[model samples]
Target chain A: MPSAAGPLKTTALTRLFRDMGARMVDFAGWELPVQFSSVLEEHQAVRTAAGLFDVSHMGEVEVRGRAALEVVQKLTSNDVSRLGPGQAQYTALTTDKGTFVDDIIVYRRDEDDFLAPIRSFHFIETAVGGTKCIVARTGYTGEDGFEIYAPPGDALDLFSALVREGSPHGLLPCGLGARDTLRLEARLLLYGNDLDETTTVLEAGLDSIVKLGKGPFIGSEALTREKERGPLRRLMGFEMIDAGIPRHGYPIRVEGAETGAVTSGTFGPTVKKSIGLAYFPSRAAGVGTRFSVGIRGRDAQAVIVPTPFYRRAH
Target chain B: MSKGNGIYPEDLKYTKEHEWLAVNGGVGTVGITHYAQSELGDIVYVELPAAGSPVVAGEEFGTVESVKAVSEIFAPVSGEVLEVNTALATSPETINKDPYGDGWLLKLKLADSKELDALMTAAEYRKYIEEEAN
Candidate 1:
């Protein structure tokens, strides 16, 4: 393997992961476990039962004082005023052009204090193995799960305890690889891949979170204009009809002409197919629209389909 | 075919690209090595040349795509593809579960038997892999 520049940063559970024989890889400058046993196995565990993930690498910021809600509402595209204490809403930190700076979740701890970034259940202030942390009913994976924001010093113990307790229910200590496949199968957008600086919120098909009627905020003008004009392109979900896995950055074609590229793609273990997300002309981004993804030197057959490929029965 | 021992299987000739060939009556059965399968994590797709296609030694023939990356499989020796593992189209993960037995990729009619002399023996391949890992 090629050497990475300088040293890769390690999370609090790095040592424990090494001892457990995890396959480590550099993910966005962090030395994180890509898999413990295998990607497919860990992915299946999450869908069938449960899985624990070390999401300490995800950024966490706490906003306090009297103007917390005002600051959050102005900075994010979602209507923060709608959230009550302990509630969370998936929103985006948008650029002026209605594109994303970063997609985050906002959790209302109180009228004056808030923490962020996913959509789903409320945040629970609890002590796990005597370690005080905020457990939020949120995750990138579409499965029912909680993301715990713990103090750095107490992360390892908290993670280990959760694994021990959850093991009997078939919980596995999943790594980034499984995390990625699971999220993609659920049609969750990854930051750098699906929601980059150039792609607008409306184009990403996340209009539900963009509350224009809530009043002025970052990117509102551009979003309002774009909404009036109608977005020319849209992010679409597709599955390979041929025997090849569509991958990130691979060129996508429509009728032998290069159109766009795959933003996120993988062989979904649970869905049991090669699924991916890519941008397409709005007119062409419809269910049953046939296209081709260029995989290696070949044009693999594919077709647009409804997203959230795997949904929880509940 | 020489009945061999362990994962390496002494009878199989190896390549620097981590592919193995089991020779029997001028025909060679090809598959990736144990080390290769384990390193690949999970094999999701396998692209192979059709029967009667020609392959050149040390040249690209097909590709094995794992969950993480794709690796090109190289020809161990020049030959005509006699049979391909069609079952792998749907069950590629079999390569990770059994790299040497049911995971065999293709059967080829060897163009030159002397090419076997240039390939690594099981013992030499093991030592080569150890040195390469470091």
Candidate 2:
């Protein structure tokens, strides 16, 4: 259901959000818009032209004090020195033995603010779990953009301002449904969908984020060990040919033997077919390699393709 | 996105899968229905059948993927993929705005004119939506 402006006086942001036919959902105790128009309309708008989303519900906290940058870089896997102002990067908040604490987009704005997709404690989620330093946002969307970090109260206002300014161009208000399809098409891993506490980064096919030879990071020892020892399982993207769409936890069989399970699957708008991401043995992760996705009782033909299911025209 | 002023034309016969066929000669010109496009919302991508590809009745000819969902464009009747709306690659929303006209997904030559009677009339299709809803 959707909420009309109540308690708080009506404002432009409130009215605009309501006018878009937004399905309001309570996320982390704050009111957030889930979908507007339809999940399909918003999702396609973002992929084709531009879709603006208000992520004001996301909270931001600071960890700056000079040691801020180092504390963060050591705590995260990526080299954060490159982030200056508008630039941002993707890094993980990890545990003592290479377990994932959270996946954070580290933004080095006026100060460092790491936006955790799933609402959680900003610093304690990363640092207290065995972080060497602080973190912030870098690259998201694979498009030209950077995330600005501020407290929820401030973020709500700023996001409203951004929509006003960005909408004059081609930016139309988008919702969470668009966000999910957008990232999945890019092969970007949403923590819960593709990564979890027990799932290590190496198994997620995130060597791009892990620097095995870089200076000491929190999970360096175990991560580097996994790198040297070789990863046991790896992530792969596949397209369904004969089988029904493989959803979360759908099993994968390699020549009648269980190989891995699907992490996520859905109709890929850009690919025009049902595509999904899953983890399988490293040897079976090659592109074009065939596998079977067990749906209910019958199995479907699924072949490994590249990580991202689609590539948009630049 | 604007399908001009007219989208659902009166002269065309519609298939349950949302395709409309207008027969003039030995060939039937096919397109998506206005109702079909509206149901699809914003179309981000489309797959066109190759020219002259033989199609069968009740079989999938191609697919149309909106921002939210995807569905196969089933052959309204047995035919061949005569021609496709090439403009769809640049403006997929035409399917949403003028599915029966500019957004016509593809055209085909009827394998049998008898198949035409098997389709629903405009009034029948409208009543069909009502029945499906109830």
Candidate 3:
């Protein structure tokens, strides 16, 4: 019961947790729920059927005006030029030097209102406050989703409304653990895990988000150059032939030599095998390239494959 | 000994690292105790040492990951790995259901018979764990 009273520093969920029996833990400084039922049960629920994530902890922002699409197109990676009303596209808001601000999703909910899913709740406030750009290019979840950037007083209520609506369409209050697994299964990079301040999206295998032919944005020039020159290192996925699970920074050794590092690894329930993604030298990133995972100083056999180790059952 | 978890066995010898060993004669078996698996949670994948491989004393051997965090499994007593419960590889949850039986991680030929005396009996181990809990 430490005095948890702050605006930018304190989590918005402090009020919600007091009532919901949520076991809160410090996640990147935000006190968020780790689990409601259990981590395993929640993870399985999402994989088997549905999950409603309390992404209220995440940020949301909207861009409004006639030049909304132009601002979005210039700032983000997706081709938002032909975006019509109510349509959304997954993209990334990158830095001017071809680095990542955050991987995001764009929602064209209506004619004038454009929604963005930025990284965290504070990002929207910062974006609106720091950069006086007329429009908001904030929240990003990489889904055909809309994150509402409104007053925090009513944000939790809006989240509940979405859960009430999305529940019927298959949504459960998913915690952070399942969120990590889901994004990793999709081979999407997390901020501190895969894409840091130095880790380029190019090395993270996020080229699809970039439109090299598109007009000038913040980092468009550097990205266009990198695309033509090709990346020095590239991201690739692989399955664990053996039982041992690799983790972030676990050395991906080739022929007893440490060649790369596993950015993400997990037991893929859908694929029924241990799958992980890693960054390796461009020459060694080819699919089917056999490698070894150095676990606790012991070398375990591994192999390079493709993105998305799991295919959700249709 | 587990945070009031009554699921531990007294006959088996345990390590501070959480591995348990049960040896009757030359044919000794190793596995994580019920308390250990419960603490670890639903194990998604298990890396079992191959049959006939030599495991040293207090050596790191395997790993288990659920959703958010991952933990490692170690060797309790040094011996030659006789056999691994292969079933745990495909369905590691057997550890959750039967850590004492089918969930038994591996079988080993106890390299030193005197090492058997080095482990704690069920009641004593239980007492030791209960003390650690507080």
Candidate 4:
């Protein structure tokens, strides 16, 4: 196998994954397991039983000092004042254009500190190689889970300890394949694939997190204007009515005309259907709005449906 | 033909794409190899071409979608599809559990028997996979 361009970084549990015969793929710049056994198996495990995930590839940024909450509130789209210590909220780091810098989970550690779980698009200065760490109740997978942020040297021990403790609860070390499917089933947007710098928070179907009235933030002006104008396209969920699986970048067509495109698509293991998220014109964005997805060269029938395709009973 | 790793059947003709053809007289039964199903993780959906559809060797006949990805199943030999295993629509995991038996994809009436000569035997296919793996 040809090596990855740069030296592929290994997570704390990389050796354990290799020993378990995990199929590894380079994600971002980190060598991570795509699956250990099967995506369906791991996905079902998370839905029914608990499944451990080594999401150490995700970056951790800490904002601390007396003005920590102010800094975070100014940068993120969500209201930081609402988060109590030990609570975490899904939020987006936005640009001046009201588009996403990255979608992140902000965990309120204390009055002076907050931990943000961000994708590896770029690293913030404070948290890199920092000694301070915190455990937060947050995860991309729509499960009751906690993410632990620690120094690089401490990651492996923490991961190993989690595996050891969680083994009895049926926590198999999950991988990116299961992670992607799980997040998709939960209607969670992935940064690069679903939400990019060009797409505004409202268009990405994340208006609930944009707390526009919470006082001025980086993107407040544009977001307020976009809110008043109404978004042109809205992100929505759809299920395939035809045999084919809808994949990313497949054109979304309405009445034989291209209307939008799929951002994230996969066979949802838990839901037992091929489901996807896509941007559609506002007129066709309602639930049950019928459409077709261009799968390969043929049009497979699809329809806009309610989101979070699968939710736990609790 | 020879079996390797006790998975691939020695009687089957194999393609580099990992499909196997079991020829009997003029008709052939086709399915993916154990290695293919194992590599694909969980098979959640199988889209088979309708019966009577014409297929050409080395061309896509249908698709097998796992939770992780959708993979095209290529025809190993040119033929007309006579039957599709509809049982897969409800239980696609059969491909992972028994890819050679209950997981068989289709039966085809061979258009030209000479096409089988181009396929690899089980032993050759195993060697090909081993070489590719390295």
- Highest lDDT against the true fold, candidate: 1
Sorting all predicted structures by lDDT, with the top scorer first, yields 1, 4, 2, 3
Give the fraction of reference interface contacts each candidate recovers.
0.60, 0.20, 0.50, 0.75
Candidate 3 segments exceeding 4 Å error: A1-25, A38-40, A61-74, A79-81, A85-87, A108-172, A254-257, A312-314, B1-4, B23-28, B53-56, B65-69, B111-134
Screening candidate 4 with a backbone cut-off below 3 angstroms (N, C-alpha, C), the clashing residue pairs are: none
Question: Which has the better TM-score: candidate 1, or candidate 3?
Answer: 1
Worst 10 residues of 1 chain A by lDDT: A110-119
Best by DockQ: 4
Question: iRMS value of model 3?
Answer: 4.3
lDDT of 3: 0.69
Per-model RMSD to reference: 3.6, 9.3, 6.7, 4.8
Q: How many residue pairs clash (N, CA or C atoms closer than 3 angstroms) in each of the candidate models, in the order given?
A: 2, 14, 16, 0
Order of models, best DockQ first: 4, 1, 3, 2
TM-score of chain B of each: 0.94, 0.88, 0.87, 0.95
**CAPRI grade of model 1:** acceptable
* lDDT scores of the candidates, listed in order: 0.90, 0.69, 0.69, 0.84
In angstroms, give how far residue A219 of model 3 lies from its true place.
1.5
Candidate 4 displacement at residue A203 in angstroms: 1.1
- Native contacts recovered by model 3: 0.50
